[model samples]
Target chain A: MVSKSRSENVQIPIGPQHPALKEPESFLITLQGERITKSGVRLGYNHRGIEKACEQRTYIQAMYLIERVCGICSHSHSTAFVQAVEEVAGLQIPRRASYIRTLIGELERVHSHLLWLGVAGHEIGFDTLLMYTWRDREVVMDLLALLTGNRVNYGINTFGGVRRDVDAAQMEQVLKGVDILEERTKYYITVATDEVTLINRLSNVGKLAHDDAVRLGAVGPTARAAGVARDIRKDDPYAAYADLDFNVVTATQADVYGRTLVRVGELLESCKMIRQIIKNMPDGPVTVKAPRKVQAGEAFSRYEAPRGEDVHYVRGNGSDKPERVKVRAPTMANVQAVAHMLQDGYLADVPIVIAAIDPCFSCTDRLIGVARESGGRGIMTWEQARQAGIEWHRARGIDFTRLNETFRCGEPR
Target chain B: MQETQAVQAELMKTFPGLGEVRVPRARRIFWNVPYAEFARVFEAVTGPMKFTILCTMTGLDLGDNLGVIYHLARTSGVTLSLGTQVPKDAPVLQTISHVFPAADLYERELIDLLGIQVQGLGEGPRYPLPDGWPAGQYPLRKDWKVESLEGCKLGQMGVADGK
Candidate 1:
């Protein structure tokens, strides 16, 4: 009998649609004898042409468009964009409004990081850890829903100020939720770090060196995992970060476990920051009078989102419509490091490693892929294959024109 | 006068290729320079002042020209806005991706949508746009008339063939 070749082994497409990830992203993993040799992730199946949409909408309209960049971090986008515009217009956000913004942002972070922890637990085949974490995350969401009317994109923010104010009754609800979330987060942190199975699965897996972390320009927890002390909050503080006191967590291990620890530590820090905001928040006008037509100017703002630094830049031309709006979230920076993180790693570690970047498909779900290879030979490097495909398109008179529009900045719903 | 003079002096010394520093509004300042010296100016000022993070990169469709703006904010509480105007003849500027890795995606997106080119960024493929849009039909340009509902509606933009 002829022996079976490893090349003839099974290949699985994990998703442009899969239950494991909520976003429409597909990862093609070629397995050879029960070990993954290579993998490719495809995004943009859910590209909403956000950038294009923003170009058509006015500055006020674009604020809502940008907020939809990611559902989990919707406030972060809206706040970041608004802040950038406000900076350009030279408008000071009200003290109360700034505090409230910080509070809303931190609450979103609590839920998003917790949501990631749940998904991470699920990815590692720990259903119980997933369930417990998500259940706890619901409390944060419920609190957000109560505070902002909508659970997802709370339309509380406008250009220079907030749309609504938190009343005494609402403040009571926020206070209660903060108490419960603090307790749940404390317990979960213990379980995440102390659990034997979790430690074994995450530690030493998806190892990335500090040098690679900096060279690859990784951000958020991934870079922190590699012992790179770069936090947008610390490096470039925005919102209430400059006023608030919180430590940036770092780890020397540079593994999946280190990322988990950084996020967990951050969860606690966010809790502390939120509580401090509530106590120290000043009373004042929550909204400022913004110029209906923003004068021609350029500005940019950076926010520490759940994943990492979320940057929004806006250019106003003294019109209702902004000249241009650009967003650079942490996932864009961290995704570059994934190929390196996967190289030399075991096939089983692929999912966990990819998940470690906390890659957001909402931000990535755009663009069409060029299949450069025929018959699945798959010999060319990703870079080489991309270049070849571009050349092929050029030779064939294909116009790879991008959608020209404003990128509605925000989170995926 | 002293403050403005000192700022101008610092800017000139920092960016040798710097041409004109125009104070547009009360607080807003714009520095006009050639596309080649964008990174040099960014690196020169960002060192002592701690203006590390690149805030945003935006392109202007000036009818016949594409003006590129690099907004850099100092970590030491002062914000500095840098501007470079690239002529329509050659809408190419030096990529600040080396100085600020964050500019990689922003520059790529600009190239994708606005059709303006960045010289140094190691590009892969144009992201965000579909495979069939024609060359030079930059949707964001003032000239392109794309009536598709992709821009009009909020949630309904960029939906694939299916629902």
Candidate 2:
């Protein structure tokens, strides 16, 4: 093999194409031998320029663009973005619209978490877990497709409320799917934690301390796994979450396994929440009346995505097009926590550890990118390659000073 | 806890350093605190009211000033949001990552999108924008125009300041 070493420290770009990350997000992992010394993350590869795109779109058109933000968590993004606009317009959605939104949001959570489970399983090389989780996830997506037009970007959200209304038959189908999903998710939760091989590979790996998770500003399952009990749904209580009661799962381990368990636990919680929303649903119009002008104002709206809290800030200028719209997905917050998770982990465990964050490469890509310093024999086993990537970041420089800024929680500035 | 007035008065007493609490339209009560009191105010609310959950954090470029919003909530049905606006020329806020770890991503995102400085955050490169994305080119600014199809390079449109 033609092997040439440029420096003692060499950096290799892991993605925008790595199996470990779902979106086209890249990471420069600097390593020393087989252990990661540091890691640098870069995004903006898939910068659909959704925010800029929102500026050119009409209020109605912005909803569709926001829905496409993440294929998995599209509903949450749409609901949050549309809700912010609705709030600025002072439009009150009908009771039926709110309940339908709650139902669809929970259903989206079911599929999203299941999809994550399947992907997480695949990363750890557990094909059985992948098969079972994805097989069951199809049911939730089918229910979503039945209620809405499309499966991925459900065109249910509008300026005031949902576009579709759920009748008794639709509710029955959703309830049936929820039952099956809950039962299957329970079974997977058992295997996720109890399976010896899975536990051995996941448990205690990518350990992030509670202080570090807080300092790095991890969110969703990443922070929850570190024993930080933060959930936008439970805290902010938008949609049906305000009416329904559910537990916020947390773990003290702050490792790959802890986040895995948190997600696994929430899968069941989402199932239960969906069932409750359907059972106690009210009858009314599915949408509220919205005006042409959004007026000039700025407000921030947040919803609990399957990954974590998804926030959108909308600034309207009394024009059809929004003045400015900014989106912050849960992954944006969780990416900073990756360096803490990878610092002491084995090179072989890098993919699995990164996957534990449930990091959305598409969302991350819209926000940042990692640049690698070239010049090295890029040939090695996956282990050797990752070790070198980690070393490269450490040598180039890795700092977390700005990751610790304080802002008011749950409010708009 | 059942009395909103009592809670408000108690909060005012607890944090005297917080100045001029304003009640905006929609009955939303806001605390206008100095930038340095950001962490203390967060702890006071979440600690006293058990506002243990973070809703969202946002940054705004308000021409003459930069604003950061933090929304917090509790099951007790009390949702309090805190907003601090810093001068645009010298924008800075204390790090609240100590009270709510979830602040980490929001702050990084604020820094990435608005170019607002979140003092004491372990410094890194701007996120969301590519490496070659022009310096000082904030996509969120009201006057930032991306020109046309041919003129735009990557994320830059070169619309020259204001139009």
Candidate 3:
């Protein structure tokens, strides 16, 4: 057994409320000097008992609840849920609806990838890239609003098919928007490949070997960054992806930089996919009426969300309300891999490493605290940590107290 | 469809006397196994067949018996769902977290919500529940009464805050 008594390691607590994280999550990072020795995560700050609440709601009402699981991937959640319900009821969605579903799914992917790119830039202190990416991302946001009548939660997916229909005028607007995004994506790709500062910060920062990725169940761009080549859209094609042709991007770098490349490359591919879907979309009604009460059966549905594979398992028992509904978001599958990536990394790289997974903590905050047993020799409160920093600087011949007094010029409080 | 059949055939050959192996859809296969052989069969799939990615684990309250489902997938895109049930009186089952580390969270959720005991789950914490939660009060159980929780004592009386 490994020794649990490491007296020199400092356990740094980075928030259930920290500036580094986009949402509430606590990380107890054990640091030896500036290197991370071990890391443990504590979640459940945002758990709303959504799974238990699903059991009480009817099937139709559950879609709205499920859609709220993650705002960025709302369409992906509803699509996965509806697909499982349709399968349990033995209803095949119309071809046109399937095509439109694919359209909206690709649009959502474009938006999500751009949003992630902006966040990744902000994490690395490249706020310029963040600004540029977010500005370009609004193009896709506008297209989503035009096509689905909403920006964040589209609410287009119904039981058997889609609820909204796209007319010719909307198609023209969507195509024009895709053209602009494709151009912007090309520019961003060049920047990602050529920028030396970004490469220095990201390349080999948090290396997740391909084998470790597969063993640890890393999904989405995180897995693709390590060259796993496991895309659910291609592996098990659903929602008109079977008819679509696009490349699954992969990079062998298996670091933060590799993840950046994979996501940006996928953004380009999603743009191409949207163009193809719009050009070849078959003409028909957008929806087929579905029965409220499904027969006694169960089905599992999987969708390739922008982050990774989004899975939903539904069981129906001849009632309007579902017998059971289990949702596994991509963040849940990717969170474990974050612990592995943080090992032996520099303390400064923690934020970028965690953000590389694009962790949606709101969707995965349905878990409790983690228990760890280690020596508390390096544990200190926030005030003590600040004092330690001051003393260290004083020992190095940089007296901050004298400097503060000189700057104050004998002003008394 | 043939891929599903091939997987089913391989499973049957590997572990005989399985309860029922049904192909519910084109690419989906469901195997109903006895509770005793649950761990052994899961080992076979993850070890030999290499379905290392555990999608999720779902626990169901079947009134008299509690059911646990393991949805696993291989890198080559094949998925297999293994299910088993144990009597509610003794809701204990072997854990497969040793084979797939990803099952650690899922197994803990099973234990916390359904009140099932998973053997060999080391250091599994009470997940999706607060530390001060009452013991033996599983919310996902079919017979659990929400009204019974009203006016319940929380935490220790005098250790932190006197009641």
Candidate 4:
């Protein structure tokens, strides 16, 4: 995390051992002094071949498999796959199930955005923000477990309808959680807008213009931050999103700062959508019996995951097994943009720019272990490396505790 | 939907060999375009119909031939899927990375996993697969034999089949 001004410009590598290690993906950066001239990304160290595996499983079995695509957006992936299956089966899930789907989705978005805020804070030498946001993120995590019986993989979705229903008591608990999240999100919005150091560090860091965002096929907050105004929940409107009303948050900054604003704004939007779903939930059956074998057909399901646009292309045969299944996780679409964002930027800004995408890849912070021209080095754990980064910034007058203080509604910066 | 039909009309006029056009639902179009007409039809849909949002491509391992479907979308949210099958012996197609930059990743994937040669998608590092993975070995193909892959970690570990 230390920014060095080296006279000798050279190429540096960043990567990990395997899927066995905590961090896996690799990036090779050609640097001109401290600024990057070109960058390359090498992924698939932990390919898992989930798409190939899905084709071997039945529709019922594949639902469980798809849920594990991304741990953060497990519900998003499974829901997209199930919805595609439902569409191909021509089965209209009950209105209640759709509402529950939307409810869980927004809940996931809140927790995910909070998690990203913590990670982004850690990336930019603000460990206090990291500690505070993740502490608040546990509220929604517990609420999710209360609602779906699991924290990460909320197994609420099934082919015909949802597998679970919210009782009156659960509804009360979820609403209480939403109230807490909304209040905390407001504070984050204020901090992100009012904080001077954060603004200076992040603004104009990962600049992707609107046309570049579209041309590079950036999605989720990355595109919205660039003012693309594309949200699957609005444009396509799957599940109960068509019934719900919310704004697609956008910002013109088109950098890491804009992405932070977009995500925080979406956090409030998610909280609002959660309130709407619980207040106006319809009454209907929770589950409908779906056919064992889907008729021979194909469907492309799109979802606005916390990270970006998550899509699943499903082709089912008359047999129980699907003919083919392809998953384009949001990160896959946004990875190309990382190379674009890192171009001509300081090598030290790499972590934040990549983190700006809320990248769902499970790579650890040590994924960017920098070295001098000596060409070999020992390693530090992600936690240890981040601690060192905080200390390094602390040596340079970046006292975090002084920077973060209690917030009022209209407190001056 | 009207835009897709107009493109289909244009395709029919240009090359009179299109077959099996299916409109399963609104804002969704899936049809069988002949291999010879793929490039032009792709351009017409992406150019005229404005389905510039290349969601991704699906490389299907058809029994004797390879099937590639370009899943396209518009800002209006309409989805169009145009699929064509190429001979397994000569599985090659033109690159659309120039039309949409996002196609670079998916096209590289097709070349790596499915053994589909994408013309003009010039030399880059292998994607989603190990660099040491033997050439001419496509895992997604139906008849792919793992024994042909020399240094497979799982195979050497006796994971799937014991030596």
Candidate 5:
């Protein structure tokens, strides 16, 4: 009788931490029957304070700190950061370095797109596709390790140019692996486009119109799927992107399937770009000697990360360390669009809709640990932690007579 | 490249506030304007100028003033940055989310980390900073002493009393 008396609307919280998602993010979803009426995103669970950390470290140290901003897009972040520094320092790297940067960048895009395709499949309960794409992803991963000395955070990007040069043998290995990836991606494309089941499942699940996409400032595949026709590689032309010949792939459906098609199309484009880069590979030093101290100036640099436009702003105060370094990870620009994507979507399609954007869900993680104190420690709640805080403050002779009213501070129970 | 220069020259002539727009390189441009003039100048920049895609807004401390550098560009890739400043005591700027919805979260970031206020921003959570972040203790400010952050270090916790 009590259950029957309840209203149709029900609120469901997805995550600050959740089992369904690989990363930690909080989403409060309001549902009416099986349909979601409203969705809210809560950030800060993974805030790393890397921006503030950059202000304290030297330029060289900051570049390393930036690489860890997102494990998946390490080169994206480092390249953006270094490009801004290079701009401020007024350095033009070698042509060979530019070619190599673009090659590795496209390769990274290939691996990232493959990884996303598998994740999207898994989200839709198509584990077979997940198993297949991930297996093929290893080919690109192996090539990355061969060139950059690591798999995830490749660390290929240095100040003036790339730290590592692609040798003839390494270039051959890359080409051979790309050939395999290209064939596999073509097959996956047919599966994505021709399969009726996947189309039915993902089509129109999360719709963001062209106007909404641009208005929301959606980036990368999210905006491309909605037909925004914007890509930093074409617009800003950082590194070797200026010399590369590739169309900015886009789709007009403004839905999950459109996002898939755009990514699949981009996978082929990356493969094509990589082959051209290798064929036109120049011979020169990979790096120019960087400055010991950057002059006083600022630069705003942008890179088309696998996700979208990655922007980095750096300011030097005539010192070895930078005065400011601000990183706008593509996700930061795309996360707000997720809220719009979930509007009126089915409850079941939440994972796929969020996954469709490939939400990095992290970049900044500047949290204070929840030590035993109550004042400025971590965001700890519960009776035990509450009592410890009161007792600690009492021992410190900090009065608590009126603290209850003040401490509440509108923090929900 | 001439189109970039033309846009730069047009903008300088159109807005009385944009002082000596600096084109350090062919594609990149930076200009200084008073914070009071930001709202007026920003409308023209985002509207007729067509620098609609906001890359980001950078907030920094400038001794006695708090400064904001708004970076924006159209699909063409020529970035023109507008730097403006307000006195530290009254750090406020109008929200541009009406033009670029991406500014919603970035504006929240400025509020939380830089302690700058937005005049027209809608209500939202504290953003990238957690709810527990104490008010008036902006971490990005140069004067916000690092010693206060001693209790925030990892592995520095104690066993709760009466265990």
Candidate 6:
């Protein structure tokens, strides 16, 4: 690898609409040749003003509005919001309701991690892994639809408790589905660890030091991968996590490979927690009758979403409508560390590095881009760019003589 | 809940200017602090009390004044919410982004939506709003009105009624 000090400076803008990003967010990367020196992010392309919109709606209505914040982690959003509102109303839900909430939460985690695995595989040019992971992801989605009646925005959460209840038949189906997921996830762990191409693409890339991970406030699997050991489900123990038995997965690698392993490991843990929740589900009312108007007070609620810790602040004004609602998604906490991780890395590794955070721009769209030219000179032509690339490879002692002979014969045309 | 009381006592003994420490719920504690003591109290929580991660910073338009709530949390799960109010005319406060880099985006959101000026926050372009957005039109301030563009045609084709 070339030393960081000797690389040439160049600025490349990746996207408000790049293929790597599923949502609209841009990263303006400054590269010292192929090695990235600095990176700046710009968000807010899909800003719908959900926080402001929530303030205008009633507490019950805002629950539905907040559920649409992120399509994948919709259950987590509504649960956090409902928890805050329930606290303000001084309502304690039944034990059975909490168990059902935990079950859905864990199921959402399974689907989200599998979805991320597929995206990560596609990012590294492994189309087969992407196809297989997504095909398996459907099992959790089907189970979610069976439980909540919707796949993407599962509107299962109400104010005091959950809106739906699990039956014996659904619980049995969930157990069988989780069994298949557990076995498949164990196989995925082997593939992630032993596959040479996948390991080569992931390991040692986008390394976020353990201290930097904590200092920059990285959360969820991103922080867990760095051995931060901060999961709200385990730490705070809300919504039946206190009763469920599971271990918080951590890794010492603190790189893209570690993030991949951490997420896959969490998949297995979530499956186990799902089975535990179904087996020990308490028998009682699934929901309590919460008052329409909440007293004047504020509550802070946090939930461990699949990506990270998601927090919601709800303030009531003695009316049915909420005074102010603030949502801090995990992506907001993790994106800043992306700038830190991109430093001193190769530009070719940008996609996996950014995707490693599982950036949810739509949720965090509540942004800036500035282009400044310092020491970098003019842009290079296609031929000059190819020459620069060849020279870069030559400096690393790569022998491209045979490839150069074939390229030289067809270049004039 | 015990952790909330412990932190509250620590803050009260450390800083006398803390207005009211209210434990409205089980795990949540709200501290009302004067605007001048906002940064100092935030430092106390993150420093001595060890609330390492800033969960979020919320800016609210409370009719007569603007309020800023700093939601700070520890890895062990206690959340300390420090709230400070400023006059609506001059909603300025010290920036805590230097201490917690996570507060940078939250502060910028306040700047864009609530029209709150955060001193010591370094230079950055407008966030969450386009460059051509009209100035002084703070959307979240409750007073900002959404205008009606009655005759404005959205597409290239002429209006149906040719108004």
Which prediction has the highest DockQ against the true structure?
5
Misplaced by over 4 Å in model 2 are: A1-12, A365-413, B1-57, B64-122, B148-163
* Interface RMSD measured for model 3: 8.9
Model 5 alpha-carbon drift over 4 Å, by segment? A1-7, A364-367, A372-413, B150-163
True contacts kept of each: 0.23, 0.40, 0.46, 0.62, 0.77, 0.60
Which digits, one per residue and each the tens of the lDDT, describe model 4 over residues B67-128?
Answer: 99998888878777889988888998888898988888788888878989899885666677
In angstroms, how far off is A362's CA in candidate 3? 1.6
Give, for candidate 2 chain A, the lowest lDDT window spanning 10 residues: A370-379
Could you estimate the TM-score for every candidate? 0.79, 0.78, 0.88, 0.86, 0.90, 0.87
Over A1-413, each residue of candidate 5 has an lDDT whose tens digit, in order, gives 11243456888989877877878888999987777889998887888778888887888888898999988888888889998999999999999988887887888898899999999999999999999999999999999999899998888888898888888999999999999999999999999899999999889989999999888888999999999999989877878777789999999999999999999999999999999999989888999999979999999999999999889999999999999999888888888888888998898999999898888866633333454445534444345556676678889998555655677662324
Q: Is candidate 2 or candidate 4 better by lDDT?
A: 4
Name the docking class for model 6: acceptable
The reply for model 4, stretches above 4 Å from the true place, is A1-8, A17-22, A362-413, B1-17, B145-163
TM-score order, best first, reads 5, 3, 6, 4, 1, 2
For every prediction, compared with the true complex, DockQ reads 0.16, 0.29, 0.32, 0.37, 0.42, 0.31
lDDT (Cα, tens digit) per residue for candidate 2, span A184-263: 88788888767899888888899988877766666788889999888877755777677888999998878888888888
lDDT of each: 0.73, 0.73, 0.85, 0.82, 0.84, 0.84
Preferred candidate (TM-score higher): 4 or 5: 5
Docking class of 4: acceptable
What is the model-wide C-alpha lDDT for candidate 2? Answer: 0.73
Task: Give the DockQ of candidate 5.
Answer: 0.42
lDDT of 4 by residue, A1-413 (tens): 44356655688876644321224677888888788999998776667666766776788888897898778889999899998898888898999999999999999999999999998899899989999999999999999999999999999999889988899999999999889999999999999999999899999998999999999999999999999999999988898998888999999999999999999999999988998999999997988889999998899899999988888888888889898888888888888899999999997898888778887663110012234356532334446666777788889988564445444232222
TM-score of predicted chain A against the true chain A, for each candidate: 0.84, 0.85, 0.87, 0.85, 0.89, 0.87
- Distance (Å) between predicted and true CA of A88, model 3? 0.3
lDDT of 6 by residue, A11-38 (tens): 7878888887788888888877687777
Residue-pair clashes per candidate: 23, 40, 1, 0, 10, 0
